[model samples]
Target: MIPYQKALAALACAAGLLTGNTAAAAPDAYPQQPVRLIVPYAPGGGTDSMARALARKLSEIWRQKVIVENRPGASESIAASAVARAPADGYTLLFASDSTFQLNPLLYNHLSYDPDKDLVPITRFAASPFALFVNADTPVKTFQDFLSYARQHKGKTFYGSYGVSNSTNLGLSWLSKQFDLDMVHIPFAGQGPAMIALLGGEIQILFGNIIPSSIGFIDQGKVRVLVVSGEQRLPNAPDVPTFRELGHDNLDTGYTLGLAAPAGVDPAIQRQIAEAVKQAVADPELIKYAAETLSIRLFAEPSGQYRDFIADSRRILQQRIEAAGIGKLDQ
Candidate 1:
């Protein structure tokens, strides 16, 4: 077995081959060479760790080398464009978060790659919800308390997110508009930077994924989660209420970690990739890591369902962008 084949279960969102049955493995002849999985985050972060683990599992399943190359910049567009321009021969795949596809399109007016036209959805590797975290020094404790605090501080309150049109950005923006508050927005290249800002007191609030990277801060009380995204509370942070229970259903859940290949790949190859994802996702250790360590839901959601999610999420994200009155970014 590969050295990291038994590494912790991970987060990955996938849209598999044209709605076909679960594939036990990739087609025998497809990956004759090492497959490169591009991750759009800095090393040592939770997303990068998960991607590396996922790559190892793929190496085992495909019986070939799966290389993970980190290209963390421009809010994932740098790596995305690299994959978009790579030959669509099933060797180059992008492992990205929800924002890479849905949010980046809204933020950048001129992008190097067009997500709709240049990428093909393969299969979702993992899925999770977001949470709102406030710096420990902030006097807010509960969701309602945070709302009241925002209203009290008004323009003085500062919040951080990965970038404009990021779910964290949109989530807080939507909340502020509805509650009639004027909070300041601070955008970072990625969550890791925003997280650091939260810890350093440079920012007071950060809405981030409920992943390993952010969870540690919450555990140490460096940050406090006032609200989560799902209908139910989380395992690690059971004290936090979900946005759904607070009557914010739209923000109930999302933050897909999925796979994608450049556009125009053969449908058969897409299926092969999806099959590998399906097989890897079904591994017991991966499933355990997802439910326990990661506090996420793991599944091999296929391409058709994945497309529906993208279409549905795009509309919701568009509405949020317009409502937030955010100006487009020039990439």
Candidate 2:
């Protein structure tokens, strides 16, 4: 036997050299193909708009096609689960809201994937403030007026939300409990449907995110905003009071959107995606569109900080759900 020790050492050296070559080749020429961004909602929604903006910016920067795929159903869980089961090669990404990551896990008894474990938070992209609105024809002109009317009407008063187990629904639930008011919850397929129902007089009140589509109706005197559920008043809707200002600090809710990848993605790949998203969100055109058209506050936090924020949000939402006695939907 020609020196067994030397033979083993030679094998080790060869393996090390091959591993180095693979790493170098992979990282240097990453994203040699187009990337797919999965949005877990129907097209024409706020999430779809945000995803399209991100794709446009990233495609420009990377010089590679960034395609957006809408997989709407199950209140965004279907899309999230798809991304979770995708390859960890950084080719697939998920653009989702807090409901998919933080609230869904608590609201549903069983989920195909655990967001905290299966998804890696890349960055927070944007946030839209949730607001309380009533029909312009309704007698309620202010938050005080709505509350007083709600108390007197009790169960007769109603509020519509995007869907059951959504952030808006939970926010309204918590508010109703805190105020000792009997407000009926009307769940719709989405914000658009809920807004239509409100406009058609199917529902009296709506708690929703302030989007251009909804705000247009408000501007046309079809809906009247009572109070926004943000820490402070929105820049566009400065005249509307905040939940804090209305003496309902506990009702403050934020519906934020962010980018995430499946967990166990290579650290280098994670960094690359995060950098791309940071650049995308910071694009001047995107900023202008988000500020002027979407009326969304552009808040971006890097991967690590966003992960921490998600954890904190999950905890807070869990507490609120339990306190409100909200039951999970059967999966």
Candidate 3:
């Protein structure tokens, strides 16, 4: 194992995986008025869906409307900054992809809100592990096969991501180096175009989300999923092995859909919100929605575990970016 991989192995046990009975009732010390859940992405993507779902549940529990406010733009800095500047009250919370707390801070130098200083993690409600993909038309049928093929093809094999220095690029670049695959990287304007390129065979490889995108295609047989990230197999594809199960260590991270608040919120209030989330996550309706509609893994850990996960992820991602030889986006 490499240096980062060995380090990550130690975190395997400490990494956040919240599982238990529904939490007891919260103190309800906060949220007398309507609460605003700010989402950094537009109102249609997975993060937005997750925000809306959790907001609805929270609304029902708190009896105060939990409105999902979309402030999508600037690679999520817009919403992040807005929440960071908001009063350190329980009413204003950020529900966004963990990248806002992880990748963005490392990649963008001009970011307005310092995540480490301004934001406190509330809970990580859901996550979607990445699955390795290849077009069915490709001759390679497995990861090892693809590795051999890529080694033979060298410059001919291609991998693509939606943006530079983004999670997709970062992971793919790291994978390329770890395996010495020598595959070329291409950046698409967005995931939609990137998926289109993959389906059209313009690109041979892409890391796909387990839900709606990759899982949907797996049935249609348009793409072959060689492996998945995370510590275990996906609910949608139980037969597929995780990176660790396949003897590839340190590739356990996933796209986390979570909640955070401006730093300095009362720790008691944070615990209240986290308890509400834990109960909401255990809801049968949400369990169904996440598993069937969204295909997400639920981890309803409270503030402390959420904080630790973000810190560990940030440190590991920094090591990954450095290992991949990627520099800051502005530079």
Q: Which residue pairs show backbone clashes in model 3?
A: none
Model 2 misplacement above 4 A: 1-24
C-alpha TM-scores of all predictions: 0.85, 0.87, 0.77
Q: Could you tell which candidate, 1 or 2, scores higher by lDDT?
A: 2
Q: Write the per-residue lDDT of candidate 2 for residues 213-302, one digit (tens) a residue.
A: 877898899999888876778766889889898787877886888888888788788888778778777778888888666667675688
Query: How well does candidate 3 match the true structure in TM-score terms?
Result: 0.77
Clash number for candidate 2: 0
Cα shift from native, residue 130, model 3 (Å): 1.5
Error of model 1, residue 225, in angstroms: 1.4
* Alpha-carbon local distance difference test for all models: 0.80, 0.81, 0.77
The per-prediction CA RMSD against the true structure, in angstroms, equals 10.7, 4.4, 14.1
- Which 10-residue window of candidate 2 scores lowest in summed lDDT? 21-30
Tell me the tens digit of each residue's lDDT in model 1 across 1-331.
5345333322111333343322533444788799999988777555776788788899999899999998877778888999999997889999967777788887788888899999988887787777788998888888888889888998988888766656677888877887877889898766788889889988888877666877788778888888888757877778778887888785554577889999988788898889989999899998777766666677888888888888888888888778768778886
Worst 10 contiguous positions by lDDT, candidate 1: 6-15
